[model samples]
Target: MCGIIGYVGADGALPIVATGLKNLEYRGYDSAGIALNNGTVDVFKQSGEIDDLTLPAEHSATCGIGHTRWSTHGQPTDANAHPHTDESGDVAVVHNGIIDNYESLKSELSSHTFTSETDTEVIPHLVEEHLSDGDDLLSAVEATIERLEGSFAIAVTTSGQDGFVVARQDSPLVLGHGEDGNFVASDVTAFLEHTREVSYLEDGDVALVTGADVTVYHDGGTVDRPVQTVDWEADAAEKGGYDHYMLKEIHEQPQALRQTLSGRLDTVTGDVDLELDLPEQYLNSLEEIQVVACGTSNHAGQYAARLLEQFADVRTTVEVASEYEFRGGRDPWRTLVVAVTQSGETADTLSAMRRAASAGARTLAVTNVVGSTAAREADDVVYIRAGPEIGVAATKTFAAQVATLTMLTVYVGRQRGALSGDRASTLLENLRRLPGAIQQVLDEEDATREVAYDLIDSDGFFFVGRHLGWPVAMEGALKLKEISYINAEGFAAGELKHGTLALVTEDTPVLAVLTDGAKPDQTLNNVKEVESRGAPVIGVSSLDDTTKYLDVEFAVPDLGTLEPLVANVFLQLFAYHVADALGRSIDKPRNLAKSVTVE
Candidate 1:
């Protein structure tokens, strides 16, 4: 995935576009570049982080486009950086996503010269060819897009043209309607400081933007797009007072949970109402529930799958979206497919949802973004309301996703008459107290930090649990590996002795999640298996007796099935403190991006 930002305004475009690139850099950071247009187009780029890029002082252009690239077509180098241009250097372009048919297009345009080893370089040449044939800038862009065969969000500017043309297909692009100017970017955060009002572009929509206006077109006809105001303040993207974005986001979990639960749950009646627009009959008709997600979101889906089966009595299955196959002769009718993604733009999950739709299954998207492609394309949507998560490793969004999915479980259970009113009320009361319970865990961070210190020098880590705790274990291991750069593995506690126990040693610490419903005795036995092998045991549980067997213990709130959710917070804190102690890049770990928009 790459980040793209374009601006047309009275203010100098270089500074604005560069600032926008900095804000959107979480999406990509391999290399950075920009194209400015005054009387001529000037392109500046380098093969490093955006902060390392240097710009010339004399190019006083009022309009430009910038890009922060996560290399896909070629290696990360100055020659492969973006803001690619044509032979005459008249047309400059920045592109996100891939151009699948670039090779064929390049073969067809043999007369044109190419400089960079990127699929994006073909775009500017194609646009220049169309312009030479007397096509307007918009028509040239449209013609060039028609020849491309993969997902792309592209912005192009010509030397003589006073404005830019942008188009999107199966990729994200948003237009900002500002009073002083107009802007376009891959994410709203790019221009959020300058404008809160934005319009989302649909697949195959092309927009022509100038300093004062933006005109959108689809299929050769003018189209009107609705503009929505964003509620996130610019400061929300910044690390308020925390040492890192991950730590700040970890501390913001309470507020994030509050936002997710506000107005959706009725405390008195214990009724769950979501923003989903589906009818009650549609919800009740579900014969099975299938959840598709990836990484941490997939773990959240696993937790929800358990709730759906236990509370709603529904036959639920959780599948990794990238591996989900729809052509395996499964019935589509009476089946509901729920796609959970924090960014709402994950490539594999989106592709899986499209397959589900093609298979005639009713689809619902649970996501954090209001206008993300998944939310727009799914039959129904439930917003996570987690706000902007800047860290590459997910913290608050994971908690919010689990809470929202729990609410969804309750909603479906109530609709299907599987949960009695009294039981539902009891569950709702516990759910309401989750925010405070999570805060209690945050208040006891010192204990987690001390555990982190003890394990900071460990060669590796082994996280093991059962049932819902299984997914929690997977999430914990993921956090440690992602942020702390530790060699970590997660397994069902029962599976440990079967194979993974062979890797256990005194220097390898085993972290056990001993929570209710996770078969504590069996897990403790597994812990003792490792302890007998001389491995240190770090236990996370509500039972004080666990302290007898554990070398170190981190206590968690005893909330039944909810215990795993709260215990996860302790793991997150441990990961953060360990990474902090190791001096690792907790927020932007190497070779990782915040969102995976490409397959």
Candidate 2:
């Protein structure tokens, strides 16, 4: 939702901090600011895009921190932009996440003069009140983190101190070590130009950086964290002539899917091996299953639930993560809980998994992140191997989740003797063909992107499908709304007449996933319902005979059963392109965060 960068070096700090913030512009922000540690703390803030703010020549310093914020608690304004200062204007803070208890903190600090309408302002003052006479910067930070509530990745500088004190909880922060000094940023890209080596700070960790050394602490004790060497070239974060990251990501899908499936699916074994070393009997004995997630991952869970029920014969239920903990507490035991999260730190999903685990049910986490809390806490973990998905509206991760879950379905089904050897092998072969099928769809980007362009001026989108494809339609609507900011709804093809058909008008565009592998005639009948209303229909399917109802046909690969899953990747690109064309922020749409780490 926000980007943070901090640097301490022999060179001046504003240029280094600004360059870091510029590199992180793809994350999306409503405003930008920086705090420089000259003799006294100097802060400059602006209420617009990072590029819109001009760097001042007089702001000279050797240490500094910068921020690009997506507003959550307050409206975007110059005063509300970060690098917020203490009431006395001695300490300054740049924060990348929500401060959940800010209201209480704000009321408590009402006796002191306040300047900005921001939760972030509470941070500087909290530090102001807590920094002891003899305490070091790290101790002050640790003390502040304990007092605060909700997620945050904060970098602070004080007039009394010489270096920056950085802390992270729920929000992400990393330390970048360089030749002349040390740095901190929300993600590795913030300092990629200067250093590829980065140490990801876990929740409740604090880092204190001097010009020559970087030290980290956790729970009031000093600790050494491992540095994760990023595989991507620095240029991967830069747009290689592409207009936007969303566009680049759309084009990168073919390679992305190949990367995701590389070593995960083994054809010779006739099993989609996650290699997760769980008891086969444990999976075979599952009487019921619950799929928990939010946003795009939730849509993937919908499809996964169907696949689990169909292949493994496990009764499956899909629930939105925030509601799942309360709703699922009433479900019986012996039920396997599967939590899907691309980042793994999704707050609601994590909470739901914890509640389920505490209730004595075996829990599994399906995600792309390797060390995310979901991976750390789950009884078993299946990494999608999608590799650093930066775009906020998920592309490869969605496809990878579907592919990984499909394999898990087959694995569980095989364990329970639910499917014959020939059937399982055939399904695995179809699964292996998905990456190429998606590549075929990727080649047709011009056609799909054109449809997105035509719908850019429209206010609403309707996606309709049936059976397994029904969830795909809902996911398509979600992707469109997530990035494009359009009003989108998905309905079962047959259920459109039940109430939703009235929303379909000639000006509205209706996307129909007509590739009803299981219910072809019913899907066609559903398409006819929207077409009769004169709504423009974009049919996404592998079937060749869709000439009757479709205004524009987005043809997918002929992988048969696997096409329903692969078709989702194409819809995501369509949504992304539409949003990009509308000049919407595709990566961090207003009021949305990539990881909803707080409720």
- Which model scores highest in TM-score? 1
| CA error at residue 212 for candidate 2, angstroms | 33
User: Model 2: residues >4 Å from true position, as ranges?
Assistant: 1-237, 326-333, 516-518
lDDT of 1 by residue, 92-136 (tens): 999987676788889988999887788888899999999999998
Model 2, 219-266: lDDT tens digits are 668999998666666656454336566666666565555544554454
RMSD of 2: 15.0
The per-residue C-alpha lDDT of model 1 at residue 18 equals 91
Please give the TM-score that candidate 1 achieves against the real structure. Answer: 0.62
lDDT per model vs. reference: 0.87, 0.79
What TM-score fits each model?
Answer: 0.62, 0.62
Candidate 2 global lDDT: 0.79
